[model samples]
Target: MAETREKLLEIKNLKKHFRIDRKHTLRAVDGISFDIYRGETFGLVGESGCGKSTAGRTILRLYDASDGEVKFHGENVHARKSKKELKSFTRSMQMIFQDPYASLNPRMTVKDIIAEGIDIHGLAKNKKERTERVNSLLKTVGLNTEHGNRYPHEFSGGQRQRIGIARALAVDPDFIVADEPISALDVSIQAQVVNLLKRLQKDHGLTYLFIAHDLSMVKHISDRVGVMYLGNMAEIATSKELYENPMHPYTQALLSAIPLADPEVERTRERIIVEGDVPSPISPPSGCRFRTRCPFATDICAKVVPEFQEYKKEHWVACHLYDERYADQMKQ
Candidate 1:
């Protein structure tokens, strides 16, 4: 499924496998498919090492794909396009990384760091315009223009993240892949940054693939969400459908772990604590990659890989138990 319309990015069966040894390889992102519609926030939520970040990077072509295709605005991104063509795509898509402190270059001042992409993309024809643009972006991310002269080391972690966001927007991209943007910040600062992101998206009419392990944040910012596990998507649905009617066992397990803000709800919530460490991506389980920890796994789950298919209108799941027609048989 290629990306089309105002849909800025689409990925189909995208895979990124890393060869660990002569005989072993880790399927970091294995055949995941999804589309990011125009001006909407699509969140990817999963546990660590589940390839959420890898999927994002691979879609952006930061890592060469082992298989599958990535389309940007109706064009095949992986195809050999001209430098100008690729640059055009790059300008429309940008990423806000997980960590602000580490993602920024230590040697460069905030102004220079943000200006780097603008300069590379030649976004500004002159220094004055570049400065004005940089300052405006800085203010948009809730930082002062004067702060741009300071180095990244001079700010707190959250402040640095704000700077990182400023840098990503410097290129005036239409889509932003915000990889766990709030996870590293303090609780107090997290909401501030998130609100800033929401405001920016509203004012700029930007689209996003908001990646996070924090389910609550994903629900707050995302219009739709995809739950990934062991390099495969377990389910995809509207934020409301996913939270209220999660069908896949993995999705249910994830929601069970989220601490409800309300006291009565928290007490009533059946906290699902899946025992055992995550299965190694080195050689994921044969059928459902999540079958090892899934409570309902059976012989068929271990024998055949479940296809990610739509079970309801616009809601897709990969578990055999939710196969719709075969659901009763699976339960029996």
Candidate 2:
């Protein structure tokens, strides 16, 4: 299915770093590259501080990339452009933030909040059109017209996220960056929001970069999944391929930790316990970032960084254990 579709966004060697001091710099997103295909939900999953959010923001051009190119429909996202060009670019892409509580303006009514994009882009011709558009959006996101007059503080966490979704959809974007959008909601509300996203995608043919730490939900929502470790992409493949046959040690450890529903399978499965805490990104370990805690680490693991390469069709991994070129030395 992904083979025939065009690439919506191509991220090449993308890096986002913050200068902490003269001697140290935090590498939040360090040289990771991937393609998000049209009309597919590409999931980025990792630990809390593994730079998943940073990567998403960089791809969206919300953060200035330190290195690399993000091409959106063959146009370089980070390149200098006129205000009109930038506005057009922004209209084609939108972001659904992680925290709904913090994202929405507490003082503004829901109608005004959702129409901010419409007003900015000049999508509506007049106040009547704007009110109509806002009301329609509220209904589209499962809220009623009456809810539009209320402030963000009046809604539940789930409803607030719906309003966020409505705002993103208000712009009629081709691509959306959903950065852990469901992470802040209640467990029951999470499913509802996820279902809403799926429905919206089908209805609007929306492409999404869904970033989160929840493997179970990611597996459920993603067409393809990329696992990140300490700002490095460890593995990426189709959701089925990644879950059924994860090639990297970090991916293996992550999958093993997901609790199975069946009691027998849960009891029989071997847990791949990753030892030690994740190293600081400010001074990330040299060579392979995962080498410090990788179960298959050898001397070469510390001496050289493993290249991210495809082992099989659509399955990519970065680990010395899977590199055929190092097979001989790994035996020692």
Candidate 3:
């Protein structure tokens, strides 16, 4: 059984929109809500351009929200905060970016890059202490202190990611937003990084908002998972629950695409091919965002947006098919 922990972050109706050509608006994270509990890995999975990364950034306040509130430890992250307040918040919440090579400063040495947060937050008392901290962090992420003086280009993709993890952990943050941290690494390296993250989480009791497009990996590492489609959340549930009984059509389609290990299952299972490319967020289809491609879409789906509601305990979905009023009609 999963441990029920306190809520570390409360995101309510969060929206991050970008203005295009001064006329059109691209709603990256259109209005999504969820809670990240203390010491839990909450995975956000979606197709490319589905706004998973944008949502993660918006949650960390890297990008100012267009609307809605992100509360971390009961403080509104989107609200105006003083430098000290912001710094204090920053110290508690950190991010491990997607691209390891690009995220790290090519000019700076690994030690300096890792210790940047320590210097900014004034966590270290002296140069000796900072050096020790940097070296210790390098060791913690499975890199040697000797490699500390080397540049990012010298390290492999996995090692670069390890550096990224060390950088994020340097500040000893309670919450981390890992936006596709393993997507760039080789297949073999991906597992190593994921395992390293898990070990670190266990050792430090860290909470994570792990955003990725890989459903299999998300299921492996996450305690709970949320599925997004076209900048809108379609389903959310525990990893086991969601994988075993996916509720939304979009979620079903995504899971169906994952190949099964058994030869018989793989051969016989009918994949739910989502028809049509994803609609643009600039002018998203009215009512249900997925209605255009949903095979079961009806007039009601086109006319009224389905409310995101729980059909079962802890299993929330946004689809007309799951609506209680339409349950009987759906059966027919």
Candidate 4:
């Protein structure tokens, strides 16, 4: 089904680096590539500081890329554009930030906040039209029309997130980068937000790049999932396949950490405990980022960077164990 879907966004070797000093640079996102299909949610999961958020921001052009390209509908996203062109491009893509409290402005009323995009894009003809559009968006996200007159501070975290979602939908964007949209909310509220996003996608025909550290929630929402490690992609597969049969050592370790519901299975299942702390992104390990902690790591793992390639049908992995050249070594 994914093979037939149109490629909405193409990201190639995307990298984002922050200059800490003249001599040192922190590699937030380094050489990751993936394609997102139209009307599907692509979940990105990784430990904190693994560059999941950075990758999403770079793809959206919120932060300038240090290297590589992000193409949206075959047009270069990082290319310089006229003010009008940029505004037009922005209307096609929007972002729902991580923190509901920080993402919204306390100074602006909810109506003004949701209408900001509508006004910028001239989607609404007049004050009456703007009010109607804002009210409609509020109700779409399960918020009451009356809430539009209130400020951000008056609402709970979940309500504020609903407002944020409504704001993203104001321009009727085709693609949205949901940067850990539920991580800040309570577990109970999290389900509501996720359900809202799923329903909105169904209604609006939206595509999503959902970035989160929570693997469980990601599995619940995404069609495909990409696992990131120390700024590089470790694996990419269908959400069900990846969770059931993780290929990369890093991916296996991550799934093992997700606590299951059944107490008997939880107590009896083997856990792949990855020892050692995550290396500094400024100076990651020589070749494979996970080599230092991977139990299956061989000498080639430290000497040569493994290519990210398709190992199984639609399952891509970056690991030396699957390499033919190192196959004998892994066996030994």
- Candidate with best TM-score: 4
TM-score to true structure, per model:
0.95, 0.98, 0.97, 0.98
lDDT of predicted model 2? 0.94
Report the C-alpha displacement of residue 139, candidate 2, in angstroms. 1.0
Clashes of each: 0, 0, 0, 0
In model 3, which regions exceed 4 Å deviation? Answer: 1-4, 261-264, 328-332
As for lDDT, the candidate ahead, 2 or 3, is 2
The per-model lDDT (C-alpha) reads 0.90, 0.94, 0.93, 0.95
**lDDT (Cα) of model 3:** 0.93
Q: Rank the candidates by TM-score, best first.
A: 4, 2, 3, 1
Candidate 2 TM-score versus the reference: 0.98
Per-residue lDDT tens digits for candidate 3, residues 289-323, read 99898878887787788888988999999988878
lDDT of 2 at 304: 91
Clashing pairs in 2: none
Residue 223, model 2: lDDT of 98
Q: Which is the better candidate, 2 or 4, if ranked by TM-score?
A: 4
